[model samples]
Target: MNFIRRLRVPRLNDKGKWVVCVTGGVLTCGFAYALEHTADASDFVVHPFQLPWSHGGLIDSLDMASVRRGYEVYKQVCAACHSMQYIRYRHFVNNFMSEDEAKAEAAESEVDFIDDKGVPAKRPGLLNDFLPSPYPNKKAAEAANNGAEPPDLSLMGWARDDGDNYVFHLLTGYGFDPPEGVLCEEGKAYNPYFPNGSVLAMPQQLFDEGIEYKDGTPATMSQQAKDVVTYLRWACEQWHDKRKQYAIKVYFGNFQFRTPPSFFLTQIMKKWSDFSFFLNYTLLPHGIQSVKKDYLF
Candidate 1:
């Protein structure tokens, strides 16, 4: 009778073990299914690209003429509200124009500073003086704008994925919506490219009669947008050159057979041919297949 009881107890324990295993398996499968479905759903949702130079977008090449026009607009109109602090008077002479032109332009503006020799010198250019801060700081600027401070225009061109186009649209795209409940603040307006579909700070700042251009280009909204975009682009290009030079050098040196001696030309050609074949046959198709399956799953 004791032996029978022990056998019955063992059977009971085995059944319990089986039950626990089944339950754990079911829970694990359910969790995995939920996670997979969530991941799949995310692929359908499009997130806006945030980088300055996102892939697969149209970008205009740098145009010196447009940039010159932009400098004029910035000097005449935007200079009052915005400041290009990172740029220097010497930069204009070195990078954009002749020294004589730079000097003449500098003479037209007022900038005073103390020299290293403890002597006060007044430079006749905007670059000599730091553009006065629009507000004490970010907090103050935000307070003035009803909690939305206008961003600095220094790198504004490269801050968005569509760079120049984004600047252009932001400058020109201002209007009202018919749904009267739209909460556009007193000085704010609507912009389509912006995620909020409304901007809180900038109203139509540019108009045909707002400023006079020496080039006789009509001071239309489009022209102003183009000018400002060009200026911002130039600023970004300047910054990018400083930061990306090393990476660019490495890329060209490694890939273009620029590093190896002349005797290795044949070997380099062979290596390139092998790499091309591998890329075309194995890598490219495999990548396409993986991407397709990932989306499908």
Candidate 2:
């Protein structure tokens, strides 16, 4: 008991130092952990009355005609203010449309000239050129609008978890009452999804009066909203298709090698057959399987 007590007591130089250090470290860690947990929880909490449809998955299938019409709306109304700098004219022609059609469209939208150095300046297409900035740059735009610059729409469809629907809602959802004393800015209206119950900086820009459609479709506000939403959804599905195709190819390439080593190939085949049956019975109801063939050829 004497020896144990001697060991338990700290030496004169070390008394209370180790205990203080350990207690401080534990408290600091607990505070840090709590802060991290609070931030994570805040990220997941949906704003009041933000609908699920605002995220993508409302439309059942791709509508090519609607996407084309949406492109027309984007060119006529949105292109002046926003730019899709990353995409090239060649990409549209080679991937989405015929070369001749793309060239004609490009020629209609672009102008060529000579530079001061007498070098030929080829403006092949508006799609190939960056949109001229409304302000000198991002900093100027921010200064003009209380630090809110209009975001690029090109990848907006793919950036958010439910990007397509969120955009659709934003375009249509404007002018709602806020609580007393919570004043909205000029041309801005209350939106539940925005950080505060305030409003977005960009005013509602799309309406039937804004553009004339040659297709004889009603140029209603809802129609324009639906068209732009379709365009964004098409962009999303275009990338999605590439990924799905790659996955199918990889699965097929590895299919033959998954067989077990044995003289009885019958047993190996039987196991695979059972797996297929199980998959069809279980996964088919959930709509998880994308491929039609049970076995890869």
Candidate 3:
């Protein structure tokens, strides 16, 4: 009762009421106009959502099996257009495949170079040779793909926010048709998860049983996407597994460091910790076939 008495409500006389009515009308109109012109984020384009780390972390290393499988997928499917020019055949040696195996893999692809005679010649790829692109040049790539050059995959994993999730979703997000009022161009395919746009030149690539896995892992679309994303991430940051291992050692090892504790230890430890944290993003518990996959549609 005392609190209510402390509040003084102003009374509106005839003139005051008229002024109030006008003010309210103006405010209502302004609010309506603002709302009418306001941009809607969710309504415009769907953003990439983070996916949980399914593999073990902390003690466990990067899933080499997944990386190998992803390499296979890239070789058989994505290599048709996409390139990994920054990667070398030797990168596979001691990382996933054996030296002989890497050499054999390198031997499969041919590399072009100029010989001492100054004549342009081609030879079988070597361990030191960089990975090949499908096109001889950007112009050729563009011409082949209707002026859209297929991007190199070497650095794509680190190029965007939530890149792993982005790539994964993009590979799997092609099933949905464009929503009403959305005009997808004839050549471009509709993918809601595409950044800032609903349509992309890249069409649906991964499909069920598209490639057989040597390890007997079923080649579901989601699984292929997951594997390829893993490989891409490894290509982007080859030190990921080693970085985690060293961090664990620095954190729990007996040796004492002279440098400040938090700066080095804390920062490195965060990347490959017990789980969740990475190159610095907290992954939520979104499973393989979770709400995120269907959220945009």
Candidate 4:
């Protein structure tokens, strides 16, 4: 026979629970407010990217056409100022072009490398050569660009606070009339999305039909921004899609073996309560009966 105990659970009154919740909420809000206000304040509005493969999508793969177009746009416009120091011609060969095609593409750009004679010489780029920098060195680049060297675009997609959208906004957020009372510093252009008081060295880069898209896509301002942003995103993490796939597979494969803590706690409570009731009611009752019988005898 199974014996059940009438277990009494102490419950918090509605008012007490409400006070606890309110106190917790107030503390949380205080902490969050402190954290938020601790940083410098600026009117930096982040824009979202118009992408189909963002966050959650069935085919979270890169748009290769956009990538290719972005590369062309970078070559024609951004390459003059910025250098992608991390990227090599082989990256294109492996992902976008064949070896012969990559070689042809590289051959168009002259790169300095050490020849077999151990002397640095200028030669047509090979399939393995890094992208040629627009300036010979940093000092020259800075001198040319008014003491500010243009940053590399290789990781621009991930390096900024807004990730990929930062690049997109910077490319397109130019030409807006500066707000009254806000003076752009000397030699700096006004861009509201720029974190430091809307002052930027780079002027508006993309314009409508600025460059001819070899793929025949219309080169609107927004179109160029999106394509270049896509390429930059790819540059930041070329294997992001593959990494996501691996993560999904690994998570699901091990999900079934994991036990939820709440369920485990409930099971332990049930077993403990059953054993407590049995010890108190069943064992104590028999012991009391035996003591009474022995006294009577």
lDDT of 2: 0.64
- Model 3 alpha-carbon drift over 4 Å, by segment: 1-44, 55-60, 253-297
Q: Please provide, for model 1 over 1-297, each residue's C-alpha lDDT reduced to its tens digit, 9 standing for 90 to 100.
A: 888766743344888989989999999999999999777544322333333332113332455556777887787767655656666666665556678877677677666578899898966565454444456577877776667766666777667777766667666665646234445567666655554434446566777757766778787777777876777777756644434556677787877776466558878988888866766687667666564345336
Q: In candidate 4, what are the lDDT values of residues 133-181, reduced to their tens digit?
A: 8988999998987688899889998788766667777778888777876
The total number of steric clashes, by the backbone 3 Å criterion, in model 4 comes to 0
For every model shown, the clashing-pair count is: 1, 0, 0, 0
TM-score of 3: 0.71
- For all predicted structures, in order, the TM-scores are 0.56, 0.59, 0.71, 0.71
Mind giving the per-residue lDDT tens digits that candidate 3 earns over 154-198? 999878777888888788888787888667887788888875457
Local distance difference test, per candidate?
0.64, 0.64, 0.83, 0.80
Better of 2 and 3 by lDDT: 3
In model 1, how many backbone clashes occur?
1
Runs in model 4 lying further than 4 Å from the true structure: 1-59, 116-119, 185-187, 256-297
Off by over 4 Å in 1: 1-61, 111-147, 178-181, 239-297
